[model samples]
Target chain A: MQSLIPLMRSISGAVVLVLALSGNSVAEAPLGLGRAVEQTEIDAWDIDVRPDGKGLPAGQGTVAHGEQVYAQYCLSCHGEAGKGGINDQLVGRIPFDAFPFGSDPGKTKTVGNYWPYATTLFDYIRRAMPYSSPGVLSNEEVYSVTAYLLYLNRIVSQDTIIDADTLPTVRMPARDRFVIDDRTRTESFLRQ
Target chain B: MKNSVSRRIVVQRLVGLGGAAAAVPLIGAETKQSSAADHSMPEATARYLGSYPSELGGRSPHVELKRRPLADYASVTPLQDLSGTITPSDLHFERHHARIPDIDDSQHELLIHGMVERPLKFSVADLKRFPSVTRICFIECSGNLFTSATEHTTPQMLCGLTSQSEWTGVPLRTLFTEAGVKPKASWFLAEGGDAALMTRSIPLEKAMDDAFVAYAQNGEPVRPEQGFPCRLLLPGWEGNTNIKWLRRLELSDQPFMTREETSKYTDPLKNGTARQFSVVMDARSVITAPTYPARLERGWHEIQGLAWSGRGRIVRVDVSTNGGRRWHEATLQGPVLPKAHTRFTFPWKWDGRGAELMSRAVDETGYRQPTRKQLIKARGHGSVPYHLNPILAWIVQRDGQVLYRAEQWL
Candidate 1:
């Protein structure tokens, strides 16, 4: 933390000062060339959903309603309850005993078996799914599909409703299976 | 001799006609039609003449990537067909989660929103107007080497996911200046405009460091396949985080944990836990030629390959002729730039006996690439299926047939 003290000045002003300190030629900067983005633009594009459901828009969905939405949109590519598709598999997790987390690596990586966060499902589907037409789903449609997929994986019941509140609270079975990267380039992982 | 006589006649006739229109033959003239048989034929004579007028270029007929079977979306670069360090822009390897989309630069906009004093949008033109920077480095997929691939395979098949190019762009910090990033902002989510809407959360410090908003690759506007119009250039990082076809960057205090970073790119350890955000691709090296399909006649031969490290520059690359039994330092080609591919070569004499050929690279950081046994032992037998860079072994038979010493690791 103390090391960053020299870089703590205002971003624009600090850049030149740091350059000058390093003996590089420091030039005064003008305001950037981009235009100020409108709130409407941000609202339209800021669709990423965090694990805590911070980015999920206001909406609710039940597995019952999700079934219809799934059938109408997601059923073809994800195919017959998200199993066996041309693109990727979203259902049918391998048994824990088979791989035991990372004991034996396999080719198959279904959403239920590998994904650590359920909000990731909602976030991905909302932004890019139904392949041919992404980002066209309403908040309701997005919620329904997320619910249907969760129910298909047996993480949620058919009667269970999902919203911003209930969505992030849903713990994924593999949530505890992830670790932070610890590689510093000199680890024995590469020092054979 | 005939062509010279015809050329002299034509030139003399042309010169006689004020060095002009005499060379132009009438459309239906028999003499002009007969000139196709002359060696000095200047007009189209054969069926469908040749490819006309172009400013840029194409590869020699021999250059092509080895496409992954069944997976129509990805292909590996033909490293054996190339010499020196830089990969020709056309032959660069490609791995797309979704097929390449035909993006319209006119309609495209890069929006930097979220925690900021003034959330701003930059057009392709606006980005080009900023203080631009050009750099030569490599962009490599963390998931480059495959375990199942074996000998008789091309270099592209062994490891073709990484490619080096001269990238031109606006410094990401310059853009951050315009937006006035909030002090609390720690991470920024970079999203692509592809069909998958590929996303990853990058640390703000990395953005302020060496990141760029690249718009050109290899002296030309970026290739459509390589995020044309624009892409994020996260120097020395895994290829995934340098999101291609960049469309948005949202700053926040925490990582967005997008699907690519979580379920896809994470590295799972043997302890039932996976490593999240393992974005740094470690040191790796591989021999390009004198391998399978490339038969060798016993004599003087040059042992050569490519070496690179995402951590820094490659300081040493050791060549082993008799497997890992005997090792010698390879001649390091000059301009061993940091985070860029460095070419290494060694002169050798084949004794006409079976031997194993291998190369190990040690980077400036003192990090050495592991052997197959070491790599698997350290990462576990069934480890995460990415960033696998092990010492590759090629068995050279006495009969001069080169074969891959295929061993099970993953």
Candidate 2:
């Protein structure tokens, strides 16, 4: 029983050592510390160009290149003019309140009216586009299609060069409208 | 039990069971007719044979009941179609934020760091080496029934995003011991390795309670879609809390407050306040078979449904014949598990009277499932679109057709 003291102390000492080592490793690791995002890494993943122009990639594509890209990749479903016939409408003056299908009775929410960020357009298209084959387009192809879509939405001119520097500055009308959801407290009370 | 049955028979005679007995005969005829008519829809053809005509292996037949594919998610096991509580692993509902990552078991590692005595990286084999524990529990997505708020939604659109499976893994305490979690750590972040890199902050108390790092579902290695190699299993909580493709667990004193928790899973109420970290699923039940797109024959039919609660076991499930006018207790199947879907049945005979059929779940906490009107009154009718599990109503037509009765929150 007398030897139990050293054994107990030794066990605790080992535990303390393990704890200290783990603490040091965790503090040293930069797993998800929200560091100052690098420009190169930001450019790679920052495909989302919000309405006010943020996180847009570098490089530019002309309307002609965009037109060719659209026909090759998008025209199959989005229609030749990209006005949307069989699929959801991508072009035309969007009246946010009007319903095109009338079958749903729900208001027709289009990209021009509801999409709060221009960055989302690039991001979404880069990630999942063409419906038939998503994530297949190259970065340049994504840029061209994005330009063409924006031109179709009537938000930008046909010759407007969209790159990383100018993409984040493109002001979207819905930018200020979409408020971050504040529904936490009410949901709790209702559940309670 | 036999004595009680005899007493019930005697009581039935003393109460002049003539009227009630007559009602039973009428309902019986209605059931037989409906069964004869509902054979029109291709019930047998609806069985999903796993994969999209592409066999990546690891598929089973007993697990293919209520399966529907969406953008990045899928529906659950049709509890109404199932006989018992055990959900075959493959048919388990999937709710993934990003594409399933193909993780090589050899390279996969679980890094446990932060406020721990021994921050350690455990390989897949290492996790299996720990004192393993197997448990039966249900994991459900918080947004499981986002579309089920109205009558227009099908069961697939309703609360079909939850599935129960026998999870085999190491108890979290084992990993905690290996990593040596510090006393000061109150919260920990579970991060995934998908493109979205989903992360959620979990309380240390939950980690100490029933938390586990599961590597196998049912009797085999975890399915790729259900987070192959390894994932965190928070039994009874919403699905998102159980981080899939689990790669990192960082113990901390504060919440990480990831975008998925703040922006996506949070529920927006009528008061314009969006609720965050609302992980527990309330008690709910839905009749799957005789539901939308299924026409009935109007005869003796078994009213089958599933009832579950995140808090605990579903103590009772009440079925209403004439809409919400009157209610009768349904018979629950044996081995009713807490936090698992419990199958219930009520043998009913319908008389071809155009009526509305619905079921309400009552949990051990005595919280009864609320109707659309009641839910709207509490949450307010607006454009909020997540965690909506209002009582679902199905309209029975005289022509033996059953359609989902869509309701609006006005």
Candidate 3:
């Protein structure tokens, strides 16, 4: 049994070395099951936008054009000037320093007070908006409505022209209020 | 014993002499009268043959278990009606951002692109060709907090957004490896094909760990409500991260910060800071049997429930019958796999006195589940929105009625 223990230890050490060398790659030989995909094919489905404005499309929208777009497609659900209706209130800023939504159930979390990134507004509206009809808006219309909502939130002025380069530069009110998850496994209770 | 035997013999002699006539009054007037109208006798039932075989089978006609619909978007599993560990595929909880999409498996395709040596697209058939793996784990919603507790609330109504199943799938790491994932790729975006096009950013480390693209659940094809052709299954992570009806995987150096991850699912703390990507569900347990609405009789009973931890296996579950003043170690049912629901039981007797019943779970990580008061004290009333795993207590009245001890922090 003593001799067997050394042999087992050596085998386990070799296994660890193999794992370390492989890194994220699987150790097994590739099955080569899937077919290669082209970039254009990926582009059609790649609609996600990052905080640093990685995937924003080339389109410019003014707050004036955005008002018309919001009135036409977003007014019914989001209400007049995004003050809120049956859906979520897209415009509200109860002193960014307050951060009372966590405790107050009556407080509404709008795009202005809760969302951390201006790019998220574009990503969310472009992917999911109008509740009844999603992905129906043109990229130009999505940018316009995003700008319109931002204007209502008072983050951007009515004259601000929101395009690919300018949208990422727009700082959100709740940007600095967010933190990464710090909950650890060792803690028997949640960290305060 | 001899006196009872003599009594039984006298009764048998009387029954033998006058069959139905002598048994009528002794058996009770209600049963004697109802026997003539109802054909539910054991002898009569045994004489008849059962149902014939069919192409599709269903639950017994007498049994009616169903998922409770919260709204148009989600439905909760019937936890109290279940036994053992595996939640029946049909009864598994459903939480879809949009309506359930009906996609033909032949037309479904999974595209893996961005930050890879070779971007690949795999069909459902192609994925099936690869070596498959099976695991039994749970998917719990981060917002599965049941704060509206009442006397009528059952275990199903309290916390039923979690359910376990034997999931079979291709390990996501194999697919990532086949695609030759670049060393720079730290996170990946999982996109769904539903109308909402639900997307979530997942760490690549998790994808290489236990995450998989599940194609089957409980020995059958994944249901339409549960990401039909294939779905990403991140064991122990928040249910929303396991993107259903998976259509795309875009590897990136950083998180995409999608709407689901940002505007929703994030945990908000009392100190003005919200926690993003708080994915892992903490340890939680609930006493399913003898819970709310169960009237007890003065006799011996078994306290049965389930305990699970996302971090690891449930090492211990303590049952307290006296409002946590005393806790007895529960007997964990065998096959306690990691990241899975484990059944636990404790023998208990009712002394016809009012008592409070509670169960607390301790995971392999040595993290013990906290009571409602402890949870409130630590996180404050503001953190009541998500990831709530506080100990649930039930009050037994002197008259044998059970009710939930609902806590109010807000």
The runs of at least 3 residues in candidate 1 whose Cα sits more than 4 Å from the true structure, single-residue gaps closed, are: A1-27, A93-99, A189-192, B1-70
| Candidate 3 docking classification | acceptable
lDDT of model 3, residue B69? 93
Candidates' C-alpha lDDT: 0.82, 0.69, 0.88
Residues A1-192, candidate 1: write the lDDT tens digits: 986765675676877777878963643344557888678979888889999889888879988888899889887887888887666888866666233545676556677777889999899988777778877788898898889888988888888889999999988878777767876642555554
- Give the better candidate number (1 or 2) by TM-score: 1
Clashes of each: 1, 43, 0
For candidate 1, chain B by itself scores a TM value of 0.85
Q: Estimate, for each residue in B7-79, the C-alpha lDDT of model 2 and write its tens digit.
A: 4565565456455655556456556556665677544645566446554654376555557675544555554
Instruction: Write the residue-wise lDDT of candidate 3 on B158-247 in tens digits.
Output: 899999999999999999998999999999999999998999999999998999999999999999999999999999999999999999
**Candidate order (DockQ):** 1, 3, 2
The prediction achieving the highest DockQ against the true structure is 1
Number of the predicted model whose lDDT against the real structure is largest: 3
Interface RMSD of each: 2.4, 9.4, 2.7
lDDT of 3 at A78: 79
Model 3: per-residue Cα lDDT over A130-180, one tens digit each: 777899898888888888888988999999989899999999888877887
Better of 1 and 2 by lDDT: 1
In the order shown, the candidates' DockQ scores are: 0.44, 0.05, 0.41
